[model samples]
Target: MIISSPAKQLNSKLSSQEQEARQNGYLFAQLVRLYHTFDGRPGNEYSKLQDAIACVLDKIDQNDHPYAYTNKLVMFIEARHALRGLYLSPDQNKLLIDLRENTKRTNLNYVYLSAIDATSQFK
Candidate 1:
């Protein structure tokens, strides 16, 4: 879905941190939209958190923009927590837990992969 967000228009004048926040804010908004729109069992929602992250990441990638790992990680953590009450398999839960733990480090690339891997296994 195309989101009509001003954040999509990155201003070069914005500092690195500002750009990162703008991107993170945009991604967070999308995540919230997904949660509210498809908030139920995996079968009912047809909207896996993994896909949501993927979509957000894809947008960032396509734009070839520099982003802050911390901002992205926080957004992911918030999304995961937002869906905490949803029905999830043990593996999925473990993956999220691990992702949360691993994200503490400076590198956060693995969290993306882990999120994708976890959802593929179960919702």
Candidate 2:
């Protein structure tokens, strides 16, 4: 889905930190959209799920633009917390827990993969 022009303009004017916030907001919006589409599915929808998640992470990695960094961190933290509360298999839950723990030490690439895995399992 296309991000709104006004939002894009606003995002373009943010600081690096602020840019992260805008990216998180955009990512959260996309996840909500995905949830609506895959809310009651059975088994895993790996391909589309990964694509949706990658889109968000790609935006995050493309942090050359201005952003709301604090806001993005807040949103990402909140989203991750909420996601942790959803029903998941033990392995999926473990993956999320690992991702959360590792995020403190490593870059966020694995977080994207964990998101895809968790959403595929639970959503």
Candidate 3:
């Protein structure tokens, strides 16, 4: 009996879409970390709740759906805000926006799987 490798390997080089999807996954992991940090720290609970709500509304207003390409940068900014109480500088914001714009549509399933895989690695 001979062992043969399949044409499509899990460790194969990622396509551009897969790479972007993986980055988004990593960004999401960072956001979760920020949220946990913010939650655990001693602070004004009311203010934290307010800021969390505001962040959700801001994402909705900006049409940043979780599966959409725009969500990556929105979550990035929002996570930093949650962690540091500050937004990205204008240049940084513009750079994220440009990157988001350049990413084409990706398979939602692939994105979800990639995000899950990326986040799982953190633990």
Candidate 4:
């Protein structure tokens, strides 16, 4: 869960945008780790599941970061797509979809999300 080093030690000179990218990269890495490690379970109380939820939420929240909204949406879509293989509970899946849909409504850009989907085949 401790994804960052001390800001003074590592990012003392980074611009706000650089710091934001660093944070987003950490959350994206967490999502990828969760995708690899989550047990194929339908339980909501699993720690990894909770971690995945947190990472997803954080990624979506980054939409409001100073960086472009489209870039953040792509990141969110990529992270969400990475979790697709996990055997999450129905409620968990609904929560994720709802989060993405809520972000979509506010960001109002399906093309960005679709772009992630379109490029996923290469991965």
How high is each candidate's TM-score?
0.32, 0.28, 0.31, 0.29
CA lDDT scores, all candidates in order = 0.47, 0.43, 0.43, 0.45
- lDDT tens readout by residue for model 2, 31-71: 44433443554544434444444444544455522123222
Which portions of model 1 miss their true places by more than 4 Å? 1-48, 56-84, 105-123
Q: How close is candidate 3 to the true structure, as a TM-score?
A: 0.31
- What 10-residue stretch in candidate 1 is worst by lDDT? 114-123
Q: Any idea what lDDT model 2 has?
A: 0.43
**Candidate number with the higher TM-score (2 or 4):** 4
Summarize candidate 3's per-residue lDDT along 38-106 as a digit string, tens digits: 444455652443354345334434445433423443444445556656544555455445444543353
Q: Summing lDDT over every window of 10 consecutive residues in candidate 2, give the lowest-scoring window.
A: 64-73
Note each model's CA RMSD in angstroms: 14.6, 14.3, 12.0, 12.2
Model 2 / residue 11 / CA error / Å: 15
Candidate 1 on 2-115: residue-level lDDT in tens? 765566455443667586667556545543444454455445234555465555455455543324332353455455556664554555554445444533434445435455
Off by over 4 Å in 3: 1-14, 45-123
Mind sharing the TM-score for model 2?
0.28
Per-residue error for 121 in candidate 2, Å, reads: 11
What local lDDT score does residue 63 receive in model 4, on the 0 to 100 scale?
Answer: 47
Who is ahead in lDDT, 2 or 4? Answer: 4
